[model samples]
Target: MQSFGTSARVGYDSSAFYDRKIYAEPEEVEDGSSEENAVPELNRLYAHSSSSMHELPDNSVHLMVTSPPYNVGKDYDEDMSVEEYRRFLTEVWEETYRVLVHGGRACINVANVGRRPYLPLSAFITADMIDVGFLMRGQIIWNKQASAGSSCAWGSWRSPSNPVLRDVHEYILVFSKGDFARQKPECEQKQATIGRDNFLEWTKSVWEFAAESA
Candidate 1:
């Protein structure tokens, strides 16, 4: 469970950290080979982490960002009650907040998920994030093209026909660890005050980005 890092140099003993021996209670991993491979994978992800943010020195991480697993019940390996899921996320974000620098920013590219029984997943998640102390910034819409709308439908509450039209939009929620800027007004304001030499067309929520564009 030893970690090492300072500026440029960093490394870890993946084998020790992922040692199944320590977590034997969770059923001994009789298959030793799979566990061995997972060790290196762990190292690759946390190679830059400095002691769970606490050991890394204060305000060390410039950018803390991740795409949290969209819990659409698409084989996330857990069917936990939404409350439990929220708790898990609570811990994850608490740690993230602890590590983020005073001015450091955290961006979670999360999409909403909705299954039977539960209601709007994104709406609930959005509320939970704000409750967890992260300042809510404006959301970015990603109108990506991915086949046709599945019979599964999108997360937001909608109908076959609505005024909003088809939900070709996904959410890229922008949240900060603390009382951070609601939006990066500098970029927005600068674009305004600095003045654009070119014509500025109004942008819509729906974006049509393609893998291959002209």
Candidate 2:
């Protein structure tokens, strides 16, 4: 594990950090290995990272930005008990740890959710990550401006009986595989190029942005 960069680069928008351009299929060489063989097989557009990460070469990923399913009964996710969900996430992260370049960073975005019993999903995830060999570095609050229409959902409108607050934010938990200072050079690592405005906003622990509409 070599030192990659001393400073942390930031970006306010997730889209700003990644290029959407699709790369051409790598040409097969004489030995039959293509350029893609040089990196993780999961380093592609629209990959099922958790399942495909096992195919990635160890210490290949510099940064991973992901939003795991919240198991809140979304159409795409199966609702599992809190314990069951945590165990499932633990497995995914275990594989993530193996594929990250030493000192690599992982950014997990999750929001707290629930009705009768509120669950601090981010808190659970943070603990789970630390338990699985990652060094927690920072926690960023992503304020999504969800408070405006929240009054309608307030459980006991004007009553003091089990009232619930509107959740308008999510968390961006940062963790490193090893010492961030012991990473490789910046030239050898994947870095995000951001504009001045975005850089300034991203530097703050609390980032304010609206959620992208579906």
Give the winner by lDDT: 2
> What pairs collide in candidate 2?
2-182, 2-183, 2-184, 3-183, 3-184, 4-183, 4-184
Residue pairs in clash, model 1 = none
lDDT of 2 by residue, 1-214 (tens): 2233325564344442234454242221121211122473443665464855655776667688889999977788887899999998998888887777666789999888886677899999999987887888899999888533545464577766755576778899999876544435655576668989989887889988678864
lDDT against the true structure, each candidate: 0.51, 0.73
Question: Model 2 off-target regions past 4 Å?
Answer: 1-37, 40-43, 46-49, 146-150, 160-162, 186-197
Best by TM-score: 2
TM-score of each: 0.52, 0.71
lDDT of 1 at 182: 25
